[model samples]
Target: MATPGFPPNTLDDEGCPLWISGLADDDPNHSVHVVRGLEPAAALEALGADPRLIQPCELPERKPDGWRASLPAAALGIEPELGDMTLLAGRVGEWTFVYDDAGATFGDVHVLSAAGRIAATSHFSINADASLTYYADGDELAWINVDDLDLETDPAEMPPELRAAFEAAGSVELDYLEPGEPDFDICMRVVSALAGMPWTLDDLRRIPLLVAPSHC
Candidate 1:
């Protein structure tokens, strides 16, 4: 099998982001969306987050725990079932990365595309299901279940980059990895390709993100 451009457990110096490799190790459930041509604040607003409620904060030194604790309880939302619902938006070039720990706003096509074209990847740890979706101009361009590479939407409408990314990811040999581990790497590759470059650990740690409670 040919080696992937970004392999699991590889260091950022070698081109794989820490969060990307860490995600493969933990397989935590989360949703990440990358929007083209929008600032973090604008991205948050396009995702239906209230501009008034958004605040600037750096990414937690390690995990979401630190910065999450700093937000007011009201800003964290009221639903206990949601468990500290917050949306963290940061920028890497023209792409705005939105990280949602316990929200499903990525599924709302209108909200996601309102900012710009978006490339998103989501995982539900409970069901062990993973998805890759793209939206543009308030419409869904493609939706795929990464587990089986099944098209949830019409294949005729799939974007060229998304289709090519899926094909490249699907063809790679991931047998050395345990189930679900490959999905994390694949998701990162697809999103990174869309973003035009890998998001370094430094970029993720130091960027000032717009934080807001998730309405979803």
Candidate 2:
């Protein structure tokens, strides 16, 4: 995928900001809920952690995990540059999460820099241990890769006009196709690819509806 931009501004019914997602049926064991409005340190503290204590002096080196780019952060477009990126993290029950307001940049989501101006990049993560990262596209348990994967699509499956449209977009924006339409699945791969990861046929059925509506 082009690399996910930012997650939808998903919030709880109380409107307290957080993104709820998982592998199955809101399964807590394999799920993540990213809450906002708190600094990285405070966020960790609230999750039954002591930010000052859970450290190797750098977030990426915490304990046995290089968690600076944990799944939640990467899902939001964060990447770890050197070994000094500031962040906070901890484990609560079966979930181990990290937080940082350094924010991330992809599509429209962004946070401010130390100069108080809009930052060029925000913080996101990658679950390197599992070789998995949650996707911020819509909602679901989608994982993406850090490296590029070769993909090919046969435009012959598309109609003349649709084929032309697909070709015009370099045949990459496949999810731009209307749902329930021919080639829609092929297009979804394009959408997933842009997010800096890819999706599989099995992944499509399980994810929440696409944020982009189908336009024939």
Candidate 3:
């Protein structure tokens, strides 16, 4: 019954991006994908979305459901089933932020990384699974299961930057046997490192994003 950093209210001054963690706290199933050098529209397509269905929209005032309900007439009749995947994306400089309501993973990191680099964070609280991943030059540089600190990729093979990101997160010192949920804080730190800047909840809310339903 414990979700560390739930109801995120404070901003971290030390430059750890905790704002992305708020999406996980708000929904049991969610995925936030960041890709460098891609526009919101292209990022959505890279994630397998149909470009014909893409539309400019504000970030959800609440959850995806609320956002869908608030869509304008142009978006009417474009609804997918409740279980179907829908996503919202925006840009921060050269980085594109895509938030998936379905908690889905991308079909191909190679395609996504082709734009530049990819840094993704996801939490599926239902199955107690969470991941923070990084990819560049079409190669997966790091993939960590935050809940257990499991290395899906070989740790020794990770690039120096990925190693540094782990260190910056203080994940190197994490003792999995500890009693409380530390995944939230640790995951965000790694994301911040890969992203190379801080993003806040206010930024997420205020950003102009694009929305689409993914057929993939």
Candidate 4:
């Protein structure tokens, strides 16, 4: 996907500010809606009130029994069952893993970095205690330490394109595609990679809808 330029603007709607847009639906004509803000509850409520406004679907309440069942195994080149692994979050220049029993045994690791540039890399089945691992620089390999601080909950200081993707995805509700689901993982990867890059809204207009890998 290409980068996004200007930030989104709030439109006036019945004395309140709303983010307005025309989204293509199953019908030939597009459907118009008012996107108020970023809260998940509000978004869901709006969809529930007018089902025709968005698509309907359901996602698992939590991570599934097998990691592969919850994520795209082939896309990341990881096995179905990760015996030991770590899930980390990162920001502009830092990251840290959230240790879990599943993560501790599967030895799988997913890394996201927005340091000088946007990059997403992953590794699997490494030694349980390995502190440093090989990362992907395009097709080549680079190394990075795993002990950096976590940045998942940090404020998203995203570039325009990244921010637009977030807004676009957030505006809809897809049940099988929850926040941490594998499909969402790919979305996050794309946004993180496009963050801080120079691009415009017109550029983002051409990005095709990313499909989730079916063989997870």
Candidate 5:
């Protein structure tokens, strides 16, 4: 949702905005959006958000690039439930959300697109606020961004089995942006570690993305 009073924003080094609004809850009616820069109290009034539904956490640091996440109690008449409810924001704004459900992840964060078919699961999702099930594709994307990873670098040093598997593909290459670069890099590193593991389909589908317990 877009609020009327926010100042201009600068995109992160990756050419992406500092924060984003994602459609998370399974219900079609409700959506959670993210805003960067403002404190929670002001954001609530801007969105007419309920005080009870928000789960605010300390931003890793003061990011000129924007680090705050503004999740609220409800959106477009919907509220958080057991299903998807992730939104990355730093403040409030007035662009009310609506969706068609073909949503997927963008810039490493889950995004609810404006149009598409709703599937049994999102096009992509990682272990998140609502659950721990991880996504191999998403995790692999994170690895692409590691500044230090190269073909010569050994994966066995960390989780040998997982790294080895990630490299198993004949043309395996670590060419991509750093995990969580420009934003959520902390979580990006954590999520990146999940790729190339000894996970079965069920395990990848079952385990949530894990980060440092302190962050959780």
Candidate 6:
């Protein structure tokens, strides 16, 4: 059942349609296309049900350097919190946007990709009122901290299990820091602690890491 405006068409294995208006293999202008299933009428009906289902419109073409240009901060409209910052990175076909809103005090990291996708995001808060946030993509990672987030602390105070995990993940150095130290470093430490934990993009919302009391 092809929708009224969009005709049904053959789609390839990658979901690309055989014929697409204003779309060419080497055309830098269009990188996304709308494809219908074997049933064109149904696809057309779906398109009419949701106008936002239109194909990707802003995707960039492949770049020779392999890495696409970073998305402009203005695109995300991410306003930095009092002591926080935002970072962006990507290649021609992919991009990542990271927002760090906790200054050095708490880690609040958010990551968004060019396909309007969110890959991974993690946060770390410690007892001394320090925090860190991290976001990672295929090859690049970024982080941020809350103000006065990093202070000195003692590794001897860490729970044995957490201490062991940190050591195993090569983050043992963070075990001994006192309260109020660099939140970014601690955030990395938290990430290391969670290494090999069978994490996925969907699990990010379910996990919380607290390095110290301030974060609680």
Best by lDDT: 3
What does candidate 5's lDDT look like per residue over 106-164, in tens digits?
A: 22212211122110111223332111112232232122322333434534443443343
User: Once superposed on the true structure, which residue ranges of model 1 sit more than 4 Å away at CA?
Assistant: 1-4, 7-17, 20-27, 63-83, 115-121, 150-158, 167-185
Better model by TM-score: candidate 3 vs candidate 6: 3
Model 5: per-residue Cα lDDT at residue 83: 34
| Residue pairs that clash (backbone atoms under 3 angstroms), model 1 | none
**Considering lDDT, which of the candidate structures 1 and 4 is the better prediction for this target?**
1
In order, candidate lDDTs are 0.55, 0.27, 0.57, 0.24, 0.25, 0.25
lDDT of 3: 0.57
lDDT, candidate 5, residue 79?
Answer: 31
Q: What is the C-alpha RMSD of each candidate to the true structure, in Å?
A: 5.8, 18.2, 6.2, 18.5, 17.6, 20.2
Backbone collisions counted per model: 0, 28, 0, 18, 25, 41
In candidate 5, what residue range of length 10 has the lowest lDDT sum? 207-216
Q: Tens-digit lDDT track for model 6 on 1-216?
A: 111221233222222222211112221111111111112222222212122322212222222343222111122332223332222111212222122222221222221222232233333332333232332332223332434432233334444433343343232124444443332333333332333221222232233211110111
Better of 3 and 5 by lDDT: 3
lDDT of 2 by residue, 1-216 (tens): 121322233222221112222111121112122322324344344434444443322211112243333333333234434431223333232222333322211212112112221111112233211112222223222332312211244346433433342333232234444322222122222222222223221332233221110001
- Candidate 4 per-residue C-alpha lDDT over 1-216 given as tens digits, one digit per residue, 9 for 90 to 100: 111322333211111112111111011111111111112222222222222322222222333344332221222233334332212111122222111112221112112221222232222122322122222222212232223312242115444443343444332224653443222122222222223212222332233211111111
Tens-digit per-residue lDDT, 1-216, candidate 1: 232444544333222345543322232355667777778887777777788989876443343442333222223433224454566777877777776655356575456566445555543443556667777877776666656553334333567777655444432345465533344345555665566434455545566667787555
Candidate 3 residue-wise lDDT, 28-132, digit = tens: 455667777778898788788889988877543344453333221123334446666677777777667776656665435556677456555533444656666
Model 3: how far residue 171 lies from native, Å = 6.8
Off by over 4 Å in 4: 1-58, 63-68, 71-117, 122-126, 129-142, 145-211, 214-216
Provide the TM-score for each candidate, comma-separated.
0.68, 0.21, 0.67, 0.20, 0.19, 0.22
Of 2 and 5, the candidate ranking higher by lDDT: 2
Least accurate 10 contiguous residues by lDDT in model 1: 66-75
For residue 71, model 3's alpha carbon misses the true position, in angstroms, by 11
Clashing pairs in 3: none
lDDT of 1 at 173: 41
Which is the winner by TM-score between candidate 1 and candidate 4?
Answer: 1
